[model samples]
Target: MECAAKGLAGEPCAGVAQRRCGSCGAVAYCSKDHQFVHWRFHKEECARLATQMSRIDVLSQFPFTFSVEPLALNHTLPSMRCLFLESIKVHLKGLWKPECICGPEIASVKDLSITAEWNMESSLCPCTEPENPVTRPLASWEDYYQWRSLPLHSPVAVLLHWPLTLYHCLQLSRIQTSRHDGHATLNIHYLGPEKELLQLAVFAELLALFPGVHLRIELVGPAVPRSRDGEVVNISSYAHCSVQNCGCRSSTAPEDLNSSAVTLKLWKGLYHERYSDIAKDSNPHLVLAPNAGVAAYPSWMPTIEMIREIGIPAIFTDFCEEAAHLASCCISYITGQPLGVPIQINPFRQPIAENNSALYIPCYSNCFVFGM
Candidate 1:
């Protein structure tokens, strides 16, 4: 009893004589009054410890040794469950590991056999229009209806918050205001060259085959990349920031099928090889060049007329500050995705949320609807 009390006080309790309390074998007390005084803290622990001891049905099954000290009790259980589950998730290509699940038997990625490694030309971003003509042929309702009925194939909306994760924002727009058919209209805000855009474009092209499907992808900001010569490049030069390491986060709205489902996607779009250039640039909007094609900044990129046409009010900011805020504002909309960037506790690993109060998240079909 004396030894146990000393141990709880962080003192050496070994080699002390053992004295048992008459009331319960679950606890030890140095003296009669000490036992009575310590009863409050010990009472809860005593019941729990007693129940735990009673539940030990297969003590002899495992050859591990045991001790009766309360502090050491926690370490007796297996810790491998967490490691094993994490390993299984990595094997299954899952972004997030669920809590308290059994692990699947699979070798880690490091153990996998590989055939070959090749260096290839980066694919072009297909989401934005080509650079040869900066002026978008005005969107004609006649042509819009034709394409609208043709099939709204792979339409993705990417929202990203900057300075946290490398990649961000990639989503397929669904109908935002309508109910009959999915009448999602994608508006291009800003686009950087990233391979995911090409992949999305490929998906859109493939989805064009379905009936009553017309893809309307939009860029809300000036979707232009910088050229090799420090001028703005074409859309193809933009890297898919969602998958690439562009240090951004993304969000989207719910995809409602009953009404026009607005499926907002967030992913990384551009990762310039030159990060220092981004750091040195004074113009926040001109920080990094998209990984797409080379071209001059066309007149159509981020003009006041574009915002007015899109019905998005002008958002004025103080130079670089506004750009930083805009980056954060864009990311709040993401809800969920097949991919997840690693989360870290450090401030360096946290995404730059503009207001840090706005809630924008992407949604999955499997997730429970947040609101009716």
Candidate 2:
């Protein structure tokens, strides 16, 4: 771990952090002097961090096999990056590059839209309403798996976070789920989608989560390919395992495209740049940004301002408490108001820890969530 203290030049100290804070255990220092030097800034979050760390058991619970491993023991394992690569059967040598080092031109965007060639027929469809649908809140991955009748060993650990995070946001917002006429409709604006573009099928779980609610999610982000801009994906059925004897597939036929339960629209630009056009079609009831590095990205300022002006309830998740705190500060600064929703541990956060974090904090995808 790296020291949280700053050096004389106002940069993060380049010393090894072996001394962890006793109260919070979320930050570390190289020495007592450095700890004393950082106390002024760290004092603000010490108690909050301590409170969060106290509930480590609940926060760390997940159904994934790797969930049993302690995040603090990250040093013992080969790295989260290596684990992920092994899970997906990708080579570690030159095959994987977490971040793009080359210019944008070399990283050409591919068509991320779903097509008929995907062979949706081979996949199980959990489209029909269950004989006894789940009405209670699902508090954990195990809860969801039990409700959905999914085996614990299902290979959905990584991609399930997207839909689970969305569900958590909806729960935190307390959005009305009552049906009207025949079905209720919920519109969500998903900002800054990246890898999610390739795994949209996983979101079909929302159909099962909100039984009678029709979901329309508009994915707006720079990561959307230009070719797929304005493209619409209609998920008429929930995605299920293709295993022959899984026993969770629905017998009902797929619904017509026009009457799909979940619909996704893609936009290929920053949220603020295209919010006008997007809102003209359908105003969102809630906005979601998973792993949004609000403090690190200046472009988020415009989006924050727009969300505030429009008075939309927007939720954001960050990798760690420090990041969430910084993001909360950024949102407060941009909106000139205190956060409407305070940061808390996301129950459905990805079980895998992030390996690149410099601090001793338990960093994971969608680790902490807050709203404005």
Candidate 3:
């Protein structure tokens, strides 16, 4: 870790940071002098970080088998990604490589032939709901896992964060489900999709989660493949599980399947660039951007302005608390209003932590969520 303190010339101190902040443990300093120099600025977020650190156990809870493994025992394992890769017997070389200081980007693993186990079917579709379908909001991963009858060994956590985060955003917006002939419809404009485009099928889990709701998600992003632009994928049924005797396979009858439970429309380019065309068709109930570095990207300004003018409930998630805090400030400045939903730790944040964070802060995909 590098020192968090600034030098006399207003540059970063070129000192090896070995001392951690006692209260929060979220940052480090090169020496006592540097620590004292950085205290004025660090004091503001120290308590908040302490509170987050206090809840580390809760934040780290996940159903994956890796969660129970002895990650802490491997002193040589640099980060969670290394442990995961090691567990899968994949070396951090050749086809598999680290993507950033955050660690290897799970999205870069595109060889389905090799990642078959990790890319297991959602097994959510064609399922029999519990005697009474869940109507109340799900508050945690454990709640969703129990409700869905998911095994603790399941590896879905790697990809389920996409839909789960969306579900959490809807809950934050308080968008009530209205039934019409025993079915509900939810329109969502999912902005800034990147790797999600390749794993769209995972989103079919939304059908099972929402039960009777038909989800129409418009994916708008620059990462959208040009050839796939304007393509509409209607997922009528959930992806089949590899397990032959799975409950969903046996319990669901052929006639019970809906024609289309989730419809994904792909649009190329930035949301603001094509939002006018998108709005012409249907107004979204909520706008969601997962891991959106709002303050870091200048492109988000137009979208923020449009969202403010249109007055739609928009939610954004970031990898760290500092990013979320900056994003919240950016939105507040753009909208000229207080946040509709204040910054908070997302209960459904990705279980794996990003190591090598400069601040030593706990960072994860969809770590902190806020809205304007």
- Which candidate has the top score in TM-score? 3
Question: Candidate 2's residue-wise lDDT over 260-350, tens digit each?
Answer: 3788999999999999999997688899999999999999999999899889999999988878988999999888899998998887887
Candidate 1, poorest ten consecutive residues by summed lDDT: 363-372
Better of 1 and 2 by lDDT: 2
Against the unseen true structure, what C-alpha lDDT does each candidate score? 0.24, 0.72, 0.72
Clashes of each: 80, 0, 0
TM-score for each model: 0.19, 0.76, 0.77
Residue 227 Cα positional deviation in candidate 3, in Å, after optimal superposition: 3.1
Q: Can you give the lDDT of residue 63 in candidate 1?
A: 17
Ranking of candidates on lDDT, top first: 3, 2, 1
lDDT by residue (80-108, candidate 1, tens digit) is: 33333233222111211111233222222
> Once model 2 is optimally superposed onto the true structure by TM-score, how far is the C-alpha of residue 244 displaced, in angstroms?
5.6
Candidate 3, residues 103-175, lDDT tens digits: the string is: 3343454431211222234353223344446767889877877777776665456557888899989989999
- Residue-level error in angstroms, candidate 1, position 286: 22
Better of 1 and 3 by lDDT: 3
